[model samples]
Target chain A: MIGAGVLWWLSAPDDITRPYAADVTPDIQAGALVFAAGGCASCHAAPEAKGDAKLHLAGGLAFDSDFGTFYAPNISSDAAAGIGTWTLEDFARAVTKGVSPQGRHYYPAFPYTAYARMTPQDVADLHAYMATLPADATPSKPHDVGFPFNIRRSVGLWKFMFSDTRDVLTDAQTPQIARGRYLVEGLSHCGECHTPRNALGALDRNAWLSGAANPSGKGRIPGITPAQLDWSEADLIEYLTSGFTPDYDSAGGKMADVVANLAQLPEADRAAIAAYLKALP
Target chain B: MTGFTKTILGTGLCAALIASAGFAASHSSVTNKAVAARHAQMQMIGYHTGVLGAIAKGEMEYDSAMVDAAATNLRELAKLDGTTMWVAGTEQGATDGSRAKAEIWSDAAGFAQKFTDLENAASAMIGAADAAAVGAAMGGIGGSCKGCHQDYRGPKS
Candidate 1:
């Protein structure tokens, strides 16, 4: 038991100390683009928030999964209740390494596994941008996970065993394809829903972008592999921009929110994503 | 008279002469009939929406008459009472292939509001002068469809 305890202690991810050793001034405008690409407002904003209300980032939506219901916490600029108190290093470590400012491990429900691959520069930019958003003083909600999964220490072991951020698509030849791969594999985190999860809730990388059972247990999310989708690049560009399928079916459910965010991106970015999907072998 | 005139005259005479005529009730189950009716209603809506969407996307040449007709059809469809087809207990798991969720009945007012949004959007679209105007209206029309589906429609089975 003592040996096991020691191993567990050593497994916790180290806090990122002074992540920006040299002063690198973040571009707030570029960070807004990153914010759009990340879809930060989808889960963090109040549930069903529309228009400018989504910009508040007050964070009260409940995400139901097998383990438990995870609530998105307040990431607004409130110094008392939000990340406004966090330093750049604190934000960077939490985002890229899933380690908290207090050294606790955040549950993977936060999607840090994908955010782990984000560039340090992007993380800095995002942090700067989030600072400009409206502040909400709502206290962060506690997660309702049970028993062994509830223990934050156990998450350390899980992270040690499963946190693999290697490039999933090795053959991204063009720069556009490479950018698509970065967004898909990292900030956009499409695999969080598209890829199946193992017994431990880690994404099954081998079946990347193939849809899985809806986490809420209503119905199956459709597979988007080239074999399954079969939409031309133009069809995808149109769908991403306008939420219309080739057959005139409108996108429904959570995907509608995703399309709303993707629509805000540059047309080139949408085309790049389509090109990447086409290149998937 | 022309064939078109003869067909219109025949339809009018048939409607006048067949007043109060009774027909056999449909043999389909009540649940099946309700679900099927809603499916047909939705298809009609989709078809009209697509007609406008094609013009908005520049895939179809914009004809003022065609655009007006499609937008009018959508407004009329939205105004129709959908209660019979949206009967309670016809939600997703209660019947196969029905994507309607229980919230349709539990939160009936919210669902009705979605229809109102569609009706208003379609009414605004009726006199759109050009493809650009139609394209601008598609945002509201399509957004109303998506907003309701996001909350009240279940995933495909």
Candidate 2:
């Protein structure tokens, strides 16, 4: 235990620094969209909150899975229970690297693997936006995972095996497709649930969005890649915009919430997501 | 669509039409009977809702003719006799081709309430005339769909 603790101390996260953008007083407008795109409220808000009450980042929703129940943290700006005192670099590292302000590793359930792909500017904007949200003094619920999983240092090895920080498709010729890829792969993290995972809980990139068994241990998640799903771009857009799939199958499950979030985005952004999926070869 | 995609689409279309016709109402099978029937109906529901959804989401130019057509689709589907589609042992685990939860069979009263909710929402949407009116009704429609799905349907496979 002592050896592992020392190694954990030695394996400090290489924190990412925010580029000094002292002039552009954080774009709250863009950040609002960023917050929605990240679907932060789906996990962070009090489970039954609605209307404006959803803005409270109290964070106590229980995500029941095979591993155990994992509770989201109080991300509101509370100095004691939330991320109130975190600097931009602290926030960036926590989101992008799954490292805490105190340099401990976080569980993968936090979805930092996908958030790591976000641009520094977007992360900064998100930070600025989160600052505006109301703080909650509610204490975070503890996760119920057992021994090995509870050991925070073990996440370092997991990160080494599965972490990815690059854009899903940075080389796309069209900016629209690139934006689509960003939303689907980065902000939305659609592939996290849509694609099947290996034994390690790492996403199987080869079958990206090709479908998978629900890790939460109930039913199947459909494969959504163009090769597997035959819907046209328009059909796909309609689905994202309103949870209706081609052949008239309405989205159920968690996707219903995801579609709800996507609906908040502009029509053009939803169209871009569809175009990106269609362009997949 | 090509290969399996084309095959799947064709199968879905055929199953929906046949199920709507009720020719296979008396038929029973170990595979591809009740599940296919319900899926087909759901697809038709999807088709109708897609039109309204498109307009509501700003994916299509709103037209009165299209709105009326979609309303007709929802109204017709809302009244369809889908009770026969629920064959025994056809939920997510017992069957291979569906994500319908076993709870749909077990929780009879709950499922009925959800069905009734959808019917009411669909009825309201059908009465709507303009795209704006239809849009106003979309939230209730989505909520009713999701309410049932929360307990009775599994994630899509």
lDDT of 2 by residue, A184-252 (tens): 898888888887888878888877888898776766788878778787888888778767554345666
Q: Model 1 segments beyond 4 Å from truth?
A: A1-6, A21-23, B1-31
Candidate 2, residue A139: the lDDT equals: 87
Query: Candidate 1: global Cα-lDDT?
Result: 0.83
Whole-model Cα lDDT of every candidate shown, in order: 0.83, 0.75
* Top of the candidates by DockQ: 2
Encode model 2's per-residue lDDT on B1-157: one tens digit a residue: 3476445445544544543344233223326677877766665666666666656655555556666777667766766765898766777767766677777778777777776787788777765666578789887777777767656788644
- Among all windows of ten consecutive residues in candidate 1 chain A, which has the lowest summed lDDT? A14-23
Alpha-carbon DockQ of candidate 1: 0.28
lDDT of 1 at A144: 89
For all predictions in the order shown, the interface RMSD in Å is: 8.9, 4.3
lDDT of 1 by residue, B1-157 (tens): 5576456444533432232121111212324788877766666677677777777877666767778998899988888898778988889889866889898999999999998998999999989999999999998889888888888899866
